[model samples]
Target chain A: MGLQNAINGIPLEWYLIVAAALFSIGLYGVLARKNAVAMLMGVELMLNSVNLNLLAFWRYLAPESAAGLAFAAFVFVVAAAETAVGLALIIAVYRSLKSVDPETLTQLKL
Target chain B: MTLQQVIFIILAIAVIGSALFVVTTSNLFRGALMLIVAFFGVAGFYVLLDNGLFAVAQVMIYIGAISILIIFSVMLTRGMQAMIPRNAQAGSVAIAAALLFLILLLAFGPFRLVVDLSGVPILSALFRTESARVLGGVPWQFANREVPETYIADFGRALVDLNQFLLPFLLVAFLVDAVLAGAIYIARQRKPAEVIAEREAIAKEEAEELAALQPQPTAPTLPQGAIASTADH
Candidate 1:
């Protein structure tokens, strides 16, 4: 019984904590990384963490409703679109600038 | 701990470690590979959550498509991998991220421990175990019922149902279509001849615009019937 409880009793908080940590790591990646592609990878990590949070809440709080699942599916669509467009933009920028480093693009800087 | 908890812990460690490697690695190609590992870990998480559909979707979309796209982009910009890995503010960003993690932990974790900080009365007072206000601390509504056996089917139906998610579903499909076209448009490599032709076309259009804006002083304006007079001559 104790083992069963331990197995099933993985509280919602654990998932939340993991997702939060992932989000923070992703934020660090986005802010600290100079490579634009690396920054996009960070964005992907953050999105994945958010999806984890959504699915956790869905399973724990409202498994009966399809709302959480729908939201997650939508997030998946948005992430796909984001990845496609982001990578395309990065490739385009690389073609013009001959570099993938974000620091080298200083045209917008005052 | 139970089997599930052990599995969860291992998966969490793998995911977080690979994610860190993805961000911190100097080699962009290695970073892309680590990203695939992290993605697989997240898929394991979905399985642990008892959602096989999402696990499959995660594998198909993230691992198969997105990761491949990232790898292709990394290869397309190959010479950039040798640059310095981090920006100047990396140290400060690390501190900010740690602070953010601490705040997130307090907000989401089961942080109900009463602790005494040594040699810091003010900090101890502030760290007093008050009920964490968000997430795990709140008495949120929980449907304790088992998920329906037809859960996946229900999710599919919900997406296409008129009153539920049909509109958003259609909108997302449209968005994907537009994104696909836009990506192709933006990423396609134009030949030099095509580029020259486009520039020449633009220049011609501008010249026509200028001519229309200011009539030429040396040109004679022909009358309405001047074509008939010229033909007679």
Candidate 2:
């Protein structure tokens, strides 16, 4: 028994609830924010919640098999790549129009 | 009432509070800063879940890299924090999210009634079984869900094993490389005018430094001479 052992472990439901709430917040950002960068930020938050769900399930349901853990790590890799590409595209657009607002980017032009 | 629960609650607050600010805050830089805070909470989650490696990686990647990349984009485009935000759609966004939350909350149900739902019998059986298998593959025997040791080793084995997790692992590697190349190219497509301006600034600085190293009398003439030499007329 260690320091973490003293407290009864939280039920898996609590973690899931938190994950759900975070995900909803992210969804709102993606929907409401006109800035492309802000929308991307929302996507990042959603991905974070997904990772939380993954790790929670891994810790609560099957810490034996490494499947859940592997999936979570894979998610991080995918997120990093996605963020890199997203930011680059945003920069390219900003260079052209001097703005990152999504509404103004309705049509592509030279 | 226990310490674990207390810590979990605190971490949850940090994560949720900062995440809310990340979207709601008008200042892009401030939003990015809040995002960093939210990512910190996620790192804390990894620690609580007993994966020290992932906790470190989360901090390193999310905070050290992704957040910085986002902020750099904000700064490069112009200080996005200074611009007035378009928040007209916020109300509708909130309403949509609230609707989604209610739907999921009910679906999750109390007392983990998800298993009782008839729509997802396969899901129920997977969670209820001793060892989960897809299409009844070789069954993994039930084991402790909290064994903190051997996690990194097991993760490595799972990733490389040809029979199980190899495909996704390989795909992840390939995708990362492809994205890295594409992002670098797209972000580095510097416009010709900006490139010329940058070159001019560099040349001006170099000329100044060269003039400073020489005698005062010679220095004045050198700048004028260089300017005159470079002039098209």
Q: Which interface RMSD values do the candidates have, in the order shown?
A: 2.0, 3.5
lDDT of 2 by residue, A1-110 (tens): 12232214666557667888889999998888878898999999999999988987777667777888888889999999999999999998887567888878867666
Fnat, model by model in order, equals 0.80, 0.71
Q: Each candidate: what lDDT?
A: 0.86, 0.80
lDDT of 1 by residue, B23-127 (tens): 899999999999999999999988887889999999999999999999999999997978999999999999999898887787566773233353365654555
Off by over 4 Å in 2: A1-8, A108-110, B82-87, B109-144, B191-233
**Model 1: colliding residue pairs:** none
Candidate 1 regions with alpha-carbon error over 4 angstroms: A1-7, A108-110, B112-137, B194-233
